[model samples]
Target: MFAPFAPMLRRAALVPSVHRLLPSNSRSLYQNIIKRHEDMATEHGSPSSSGEMHDALDVLSSESSPISTIPLDPDTDYAALAIPSLQSKNKANLPPLMNIPPQEDPLLHHIASRIMNHGERAKASRTVSQMLLHLHAWTRSPPLPILRQAIFKLSPAVKVIGHKHSTKMIYKPVPLSEKQGIWLATEWILDAIKGRQGGPTLAERMAREVILILKNESKTLEKKEAYHKSAMMNRGNIAIART
Candidate 1:
């Protein structure tokens, strides 16, 4: 009975020692495996078994090729992107002078120059000259038939006021010539520029007078058109006068 009990007790004592050795061996094996993985990761430019493979791949790819690492648009214009500041610099470096032709008419050139330099009198003078020149061109050497017709239209009607019952009308023809018409037009323009005797002065009313004189519906322009229309209607007079 004692011998059997002794074997049982020795086996029970060996079981605790085996359990203690098993834990130490398993821990050393696990540490060795972890160290081996770290060494492999260092050699291959990757991370250990810590789940950092994606981050390691990004770093490795960026370090391999720097140009390809940055994302760029396929249609991007690299040259335009590189020197954006040069465009403004080139514009600033251009010469200030411009190419323009000189005015042919001396009076027109003078007026334009003065207007550009903000001369007050130049504008008034220009307006007067322009109106006069236009009127002169239209009225100069008008057909004799047209002149007679215009005069007839302009003739004043004299009404004879009789005492009892009879009433009569007399037409007085106003003599008009192309020279006279041109002279009157010039004088009219001058008066407008100078303003009325009791009205505004040239400095105060020059612009207003200029606008009125140069208008298409002006009295002077209406007179010119009336003359032209009257001439057209009396074309037969032109043939008669030539005879």
Candidate 2:
């Protein structure tokens, strides 16, 4: 009888009616909160847990990539750190020619004057002469020979002051011919004047400043030369009239 009574008491203790039960309101409230949260998630079309986790991982990975890829320490960029020095070294190593000042060719002034004085004739002469100067400067060639060669190349209509008027004496102008020749000539002479070339020394760069000044006076020089020429032509006409 005692054993059966003890077994019944244990069974009663385990049963819900004999136990301290959860309040019905509390249980209902908890269930409602869980269901409401599920409904709200469904209404909002929120991503599932696994999807949310994957998205977060993707974001984290993207943010971390650049930081991990690039070096944090400035010193670690050996190439970047050395770049300024390398550039300086390279600049220093450049040929002394590039650093040289512009050349002072007296011929430039003389040629310029000839151009202004002669107008069409002198202009054409100046153009050809300047082109020749460029060549002479570039090749370090002897002045008179280049001048002679250039004169030979001019059109028959384009005559240097002393060139023969014969058809056999004139040379034709080729297309794209003057372009390269002029470039080479200008750069070469500029280098030579700047002391880059091993040749006969030219006037100092300071003296070259005088040429620039004269270049400004080119307009006045033109008027004087024109007046002189007109007077001479007038005298020639008067002599012819008397005859």
Candidate 3:
């Protein structure tokens, strides 16, 4: 009986110490978990469970301020935007006056003065003559029948005084040399200058018409440019053939 009672007493004494040790271990574990959470938040650069994070989030979610407005440029061409086509057409129709060379021919000067007394008209006539001369000079050989046919394919019928002053008109493709072409062109241009029956004088009308015709006849220049471009592209083949 004494032996059994002694064992029971020792067991009862160990219970309080075990309970005290258990409370200290639990407190230390709780502190360690809290410290680990704080360190993780600091490392990640996140808000540490504070009201300052809420304030920062609110500021970020707020609406942005409006951008500052700027006035239109004073130098902007508003009228051009309204009538662009008409403006472009007018610019296209403007005469290439700068291309006209100065006139020295006494006959052209006299005729220009007699018709309009303007120096500009004389210069324009000279320009027309020079253009025709250049066209003639560009020919590598005497005019071909095919070239004449092609050029005059759309030739207009001409009315001429026939026998007993009866008028006759006909379309004929006559082969012409460079000199003849220049001569004919000069005569036609002169006739155009002097043949106005009414309205503006011949010189004034001729000056305007020459510029308009040059613009309209740009297709010829375009064709020449195309031919040169083709020749340039095939130059290597031409050289090979020559060799």
Candidate 4:
């Protein structure tokens, strides 16, 4: 009976000792101590079995009181983070892409062809001048029996007024001064064509002659005003002298 009583007393003492060792919040306190120990071990170069445990602890701590909350810099280069930035740099150096238009027919193709084949410039200018010369005969655009008479008749004529006054006939002379110049230029071009000095083209010669005529007419207009004034003054002087 004394032996059983001693065993029971020992069991009661063991219970009190165990209870003292483990307090009411012992489980939570033990977990915290284990987490702090893991962090210290990691800082000292001791890797954890699974780093997820430390990461979870860190996230929880940060949530409670964040250490940093600022955003990353906008100017921070992500390309620099790559293993080799030369790959991107090389691509940028490549030539730019372009969609070039294809070659087509030129706008002056017809005009150029006429000039090359028929020598239309010299002939056209002469023809136009000849038609203008016969303007009085063909007011109603009648069939002039003289047009089919000869090639020379269809050509330009230079005045016999010597080299200084070699005048060719022009078809469309807007100004009187231009009228004489165009006529002379047309005759010069016609003579060149007949003498084989120039190609048969006439249209270009005609256009050039017409332009020259216009320039001359503009210059002559200035003289025309002076001549009119002088003539008036002369007539007045003559009238006064007679009186």
Query: For each candidate, what TM-score against the reference?
Result: 0.23, 0.18, 0.21, 0.16
lDDT of 1 by residue, 1-243 (tens): 589699889876765323344465674665566667777888887764434643433443342423347788989998887686788778879878886865444333432343333556667565535544444455564333332333333322221122332575332223356545544444443454542676754333433433444444334445545555555554433323343
For model 3, what is the alpha-carbon lDDT of residue 238? Answer: 28
* Model 1 vs truth, CA RMSD: 32.7
Better model by TM-score, 3 or 4? 3
In order, the Cα lDDT scores of the candidates are 0.47, 0.44, 0.46, 0.43
RMSD of each: 32.7, 28.8, 34.3, 32.1
**Deviation of model 4 at 236, angstroms:** 1.0
Per-residue lDDT for 55-137 in model 4, tens only?
65455433243456778779987667773667777787987889785462221232233334366555534455554344324
Ranking by TM-score: 1, 3, 2, 4
lDDT of 4: 0.43
Model 2 Cα shift for residue 117 (angstroms): 3.7
After superposition, the stretches of candidate 3 with alpha carbons farther than 4 Å from their true spots are: 1-175, 217-243
For this target, which candidate reaches the highest TM-score against the unseen true structure? 1
**Which lDDT tens digits does candidate 3 get at residues 66-160?**
34598977899867676988878899899666756666544344334434335577565655354334334544333233223333331222222
What lDDT is obtained when candidate 2 is compared to the true structure?
Answer: 0.44
Comparison by lDDT, 3 against 4, better one: 3
Q: Write the per-residue lDDT of candidate 2 for residues 106-193, one digit (tens) a residue.
A: 4354434433433565564545455556555655766546443432232122111222346543322222234433333333234434
Cα miss at 101, model 3 (Å)? 15
For every model shown, the clashing-pair count is 0, 3, 0, 14
